[model samples]
Target chain A: MGLTRTSLTAEIGRGANYTDKHDCVVALAGNPNVGKSTVFNALTGMHQHTGNWSGKTVGTAFGRYTYDERTYSVVDLPGTYSLLTHSKEEDAAKDFLVNETPHLTVVVSDAACLERNLNLVLQILEVTPKVLLCVNLIDEAKKRHIKIDIGKLKKHLGIPVIAITARSKKDIERLKEEITRATDNPSESAYTVQYDDEIEKAITTLREGGVGTRFEALRLLDGTPEAGGDSVPSGAADAVAALQIARTAAELSDEIAKALVKTAEFIAKEVVFVEKATDMRREKIDRVLTGRIFAYPVMLLLLLLIFWITIVGANYPSSFLSNLFSSFEMPICRFLQRLGVPQFFTEMLVFGMYRVLYWVVSVMLPPMAIFFPLFTLLEDVGYLPRIAYNLDRCFHKCSTCGKQALTMCMGFGCNAAGVVGCRIIDSPRERLIAILTNNFVPCNGRFPLLIAMTSMFFISADTAASSFWGAAFLAAIIIFSVMITLFVSSLLSKTLLRGVPSSFTLELPPYRRPQILSVLVRSLLDRTIFVLGRAVAVAAPAGIVIWLLANINVGDASLFAHLTDLLNPLGKIMGMDGVILLAFILGFPANETVIPIMMMGYMAEGTIKGYESLSALKTLLEANGWTWVTALTVVLFSLMHWPCSTTLWTIKKESGSLKWTAVAFLLPTVIGAITCILVNFVFGFTL
Target chain B: MISLSYTPMCALSPGECGTVSDITLGGAMRRRLQDIGLIPGTSVRCVGVSPLGDPRAYEIRGAVIALRNDDAEAVHITR
Candidate 1:
């Protein structure tokens, strides 16, 4: 395919133009959340768009760059570790590189940990010769005192090495210059280490079809199907059996194992070098973080501390903001009163709709603002890897890799992101297991629901002491969600995705003093705005519906009250009232607003004071009817119940199977109801 | 069985374990396995199977590696 000038500029539109004989296909690959998006944006500017790779839910981003009148189409393959076909991202990366044969493959590795990064680079080098290693994140690496010898690395690999800070334009420009100069199909260089003879013999025989021996050898080593595209198809098992006639299958497998070990040693010696000797600082920290005895406790303590900070710190700001917003409402209400506006319309518009919106922003924003930065702080400090390491055993018990824990943690932030994050699990079965169990961990949306329940039913918000105790009690409920996650993961592993867990070489990234100022700014703006945007979009219409439900009365009761009464029987069985059930049903758009809407319903006629503390909240709930049993049931249900509609939509988008999305919706709800019913039966509420 | 934990049992699928076998894997396939310490003579063990019945998980030293059964079929193991 000669590079004909298709006037692709017109096709691709104003952002990029195509010139003749570009003859270069550069594949952008990296680890997830490593500023891959930032790099892509900088390189392609406004010309980038996302598309599916034929059938997969995995989105492939492709962009065009023009330099000196030549156009290069850059395919930003999904961020993946190694191109093993276990996860969707890996499957996408392997398919693109093997089938598409990108003329220039740019493997972006985090410069902070070069050894682990080399694993992906080495895998690509084995497959193709036209690869330019882009050691991205030079800035991050420098912060951790990592100094890479780019020139030496280039000489060692016999390929162009570009040191780039992906977010920086100058670094990207330098990379583009190297890409422009690199060969499309360079002479293939072998980077394979010696394997044992039996494995070698099997590999040699597999390659009898004249498909390269290295491809067969590595496929055998990694055990992924799409490693060589269609070099071998599954339906040809008979042919494979016929080919292996000379050697027993067991013999062939043993040979590959030897090759794996020998290759690891050879590569480790050549590519990896530690500038400094092993030190006590990192080791001491790891002992505490990854210790068999201390690890889980430390993890719990850290979680509790984060939640405590979020609950306590959020209150003052939330109240201050609410008071500010409520003060404005009073003035507005008086003006409307002066204008001779009717009481009902004024209450519906200002109190019903506005108060709910204000509660959502006030109650939810502070926690998100405080918590995201703290979470990002841990991530920035590189403590997340240690978390993966600490939790590896637990993940292994679930027949998945330890990295799946990271995805599970992401689920706490957002389930959809967690589902996408499962790319870290290289095994498809393991990845599926992670995705299925991810929703068991409650996201931030569910937190407000849990906290509101705790405050209303279990602890009073009238006093400061009660608020503090109530927040602690709610923190326990969040921890309970994690416990449930562990239990469900075990069940799924043994029953559905049964297997010995895949061993992963965990790199414990050394901790550094967090970039607090930068992390707070980026996470606050990026994550907070991103979440609030979703809430506003979905919750605005939901608020209007809620207003309508409370206002439009049929005979003696309004639509909301009527529905709540209808659901009362089932709700009472689970230690909650019909109103609580109806609120959850309507609050499917955003769980954070469930409490405010409930309050709107409770104080239908009278002007209600939004409780300033947890004790006062409990006094109000007690007046309405609440016991500790009700609080416990509500918290449990909130944690285990069906995810919001947005999360369900994301599940559909990520799984690409409406069947799985349906399963995702039903499975959690069933478990939630069963658990709550059992708890209520055993504990017998006194109300 | 002195059982040195670091030197994992050589119990991979017959095709994957070789006695110093000569092989070359180019492109993405090679690095995918290489990244996870699936280098030559790593003494990988095919300990279990995934439910989909394709990708198999292996134990290498103290770590575990999961790959597809098709990928496992490619590896030539030596006794």
Candidate 2:
């Protein structure tokens, strides 16, 4: 890894030279919503889930770009405002810079908001001197009449600086070439963020005592520096020596933080010139979006519009897919039998596993396919933080950080992702509150069932009026679940995870024009297909297990019947029958399988199937003694039940406690049970 | 000590701009605030509040950051 100069032209020329692969590692760090992920995508050609919001990248995403006939592996570290804080995600960013010591750390900053973005850049410079300043989103800045003197910033920061908009291929190639050159000849910055006199004296004392570096002394002075656990991999002398620094440099002080902030404010003022009209333009839009009169209505309207679009768009494709899958049953059975398959095997494979797979795919796929991309479009446009802003008071009242609103939004897509998104919340207690209550919102897998039931039972018989009322009613149900989320979050905070709300700086970023094409493709691949693939995997094994439960007879009745009979009394108290309760229990592996399991229980012979119409499904439920009360109770339970297996696993992984995992499981289940029993108990007296 | 001329940051209305006179917040959060350029002498403008009107967005250091009412009131400012 000696310094060998790779010419810029040679680096930019594709397939122009053949040499040994360098495998140079480069890490991208930035403030949230600074087009950091876009730079990663441009450099590595991997669509790494770019979005225009804070904490969009919850964890590191890795990709490789080839330059100068050498492959440069890039790690996109999660965006943070400053590494000065003790946030888990920020610690991850700081840890990577300190420990892994990537060959070059490209500190990406939004050129438009260079003043605030420099706060993080200067902090990273403290950790290691091997940093290249890539001031991104230059085009947006230029459009807003903000000009940054890249050369002046370079000299002031005393680091190599380059400004490039992520859109231009030429700029990305230049970035790659710069990566090569910077990695080859690393220059220590002459500029340092001068702290106040007191901290400087302390640093000097620690420095004289062989504390390795000024940065190490500062880190040791941090309230809680995550250090010294695993620095062996990089084997950098700085990492090793930093591990030896005494923890007695100084108490965490305002002088150090203020100095950093003051320096950033100074440099930004020196290098940037702005017309200042852009904020006014965005403020008008934000006023309407988060304005008192229109905020909730606009949110509800957006939710309704998305649901209406999904319900209407998914109708034809769902039917087509179902018809296509069903139309193949006989041929598949015939082909299997002709190959000398046994009846039991044929029944299990085709009628059981295959039927369940197709049913889940047809029913679950279309809506998710439509809904996720629409949701991703919202995320990309930076509407999420505004949502957090609008809903902050509600969360504050609940003693939780408002960012839970964003995680709850993710829960609308998938509970697992929502749990993972809880990483954005700074407080461990609030993060738990967010995780435990995330399941109160129905995920995409549960949405189709809720919509179906909402339409079938709640609305009037007029087809003309039903569609509008259906969307309204669906939104009402979602709101009810969100209310439950707040209630539970508050309850748990007061009882189990009680604490004052942690302060967080919610940055409402400038909205970017969403990449609609790539959003469609990425959502379809990343979210829809990924979730669908998990459903399929779970649904198949579940199908075979459920077939055994339904078919294998115990006593005079089948095992499924006996099991339902066992649960019948409890189910009666909950307003749903034994079979529905059993279906929910069996559906624990995957919520997508709940409908098929219920269908199997209601229709005799246990042969899996899909109904052609919502009307037909309604008729079947009515025949099975489902009144509007039953339907209401069912929706309530669906909205407030135990999280599915994937979500539980994610909760376990994220929370890292079996106790919390069990609490997450039982909290919702208990609430759902109590809510259902009370509903049934009250209706039992009145209706 | 509390100053006579400094107004509670929560009192600032939309379109009103102020220079931060003091931050009376404590602990890590106070440091967090300072780390983002919210120290004394930085200019902060009350952009607008969310519909619920608790967490208000303030333009600090060329960025719009919304702080909850409780957090906002901790910062003392003067027009």
Score candidate 1 by lDDT: 0.62
Q: Which residue pairs show backbone clashes in model 2?
A: none
List of chain B TM-scores, one per candidate: 0.58, 0.91
Q: Write the per-residue lDDT of candidate 1 for residues A58-118, one digit (tens) a residue.
A: 3565667787667887767776656544556677677777777777887777665555556
Question: What lDDT would each prediction earn against the true structure?
Answer: 0.62, 0.81
The docking quality of candidate 2, as DockQ, is: 0.76
Report how far residue A252 has shifted in candidate 2, in Å. Answer: 7.1
DockQ per model, Cα = 0.10, 0.76
True contacts kept of each: 0.08, 0.86
Model 2 alpha-carbon miss at residue A97, Å:
1.6
Off by over 4 Å in 2: A1-22, A196-198, A221-252, B1-5
Docking class of 1: incorrect
- The 10-residue segment of model 2 chain A with minimum total lDDT is A1-10
Please give the clash total of every predicted structure, in order.
93, 0
